[model samples]
Target: MRETAYWLINIACAIVILVLLGVHMGVMHLDAILARLVGTVPEPLAWENMVNRGKSTTQVVLYIVLLGTALFHGFYGLRTMLLEFFSSDRAARVITAGCVTAGGVLFVTGTAVTVVFALNGAG
Candidate 1:
């Protein structure tokens, strides 16, 4: 049951990542394409834009969700790929451990950066 629950959670995360990342990319880059079509200058990708977006509670939360989902999907997918190359149970265990460690480090770093930007305000 526990293993099944965990697998379900990973599947949920993958679905969330797919949906949210699509929304994120559209929101972040659609303006450029729209501006071209409308014959206007698009918003510059500048520090001000970053700071503004980072300062938004909605954007911050969205980014946090994106980061978590992306990391889980990427690391979990990588672990599965790595496992396919190794036949030994011991090798699989080691690969899983390494994936978990790498994922944790990356997640922490990403979360810290998100928090810092959100807290620092316009920088």
Candidate 2:
């Protein structure tokens, strides 16, 4: 039952990652296409545009969410693979602990940076 729940959560995280990463790519990498289609700014990565986005609460929240979701999805996937390869209860425990700890640290750090950037208005 516990494993099942974890698997389900992992799957959900993957879906969230796909959506968030797609948005990130479109906004940061497809500036030309978006500008042509919707008359957006020609350079999404321009300093002014970046500062604007960094100052936006919505963008900050989305960035945090994306960071967390990506970390959870990646760490869970890595844990699954390590467990399968090791196939021991002790290995399972160690792998799970390591992944959880690393993921938590990364999430906290990323969230802190995002919040700080937002507060500083990307200046």
Candidate 3:
């Protein structure tokens, strides 16, 4: 049951990633195109823009969800690949632990950065 749940979760995460990432890419590219049309190109990574985005509750939540799902999806994929390479259950368990640890650290860091941007009003 647990293994099945993991597979199902990964499938759900992948679907979510496809939809969310498409929207993300569209917004980023569209913003650049709109800026160009106005004869002014905005800096993509400007701290002010980032802070502004983070200031919006909806945008901040969306970013947090995207970050979490992407991290889990990518790390779970890595765990699966590592398991494939090692026939030993012990090795696979170790790999899973490592992946989980690394994913947790990265997720926390990403969330913290987002929160910092929101609180500081400047990145």
Provide the RMSD of all predictions against the true structure, rounded to 1 decimal: 3.5, 1.5, 3.4
Window of ten residues with lowest summed lDDT in model 2? 37-46
**How much is the lDDT of residue 121 in candidate 3?**
71
lDDT ranking, high to low = 2, 3, 1
Off by over 4 Å in 1: 1-3, 32-46
TM for every model, in the order presented, reads 0.77, 0.90, 0.81
- CA lDDT of each candidate? 0.80, 0.87, 0.81
Once superposed on the true structure, which residue ranges of model 2 sit more than 4 Å away at CA?
none
TM-score of 1: 0.77
Report the C-alpha lDDT of model 3 over 51-73, residue by residue, as the tens digit: 67788788778888888889889
What alpha-carbon RMSD in Å does predicted model 1 have with respect to the real structure? 3.5
Best by TM-score: 2
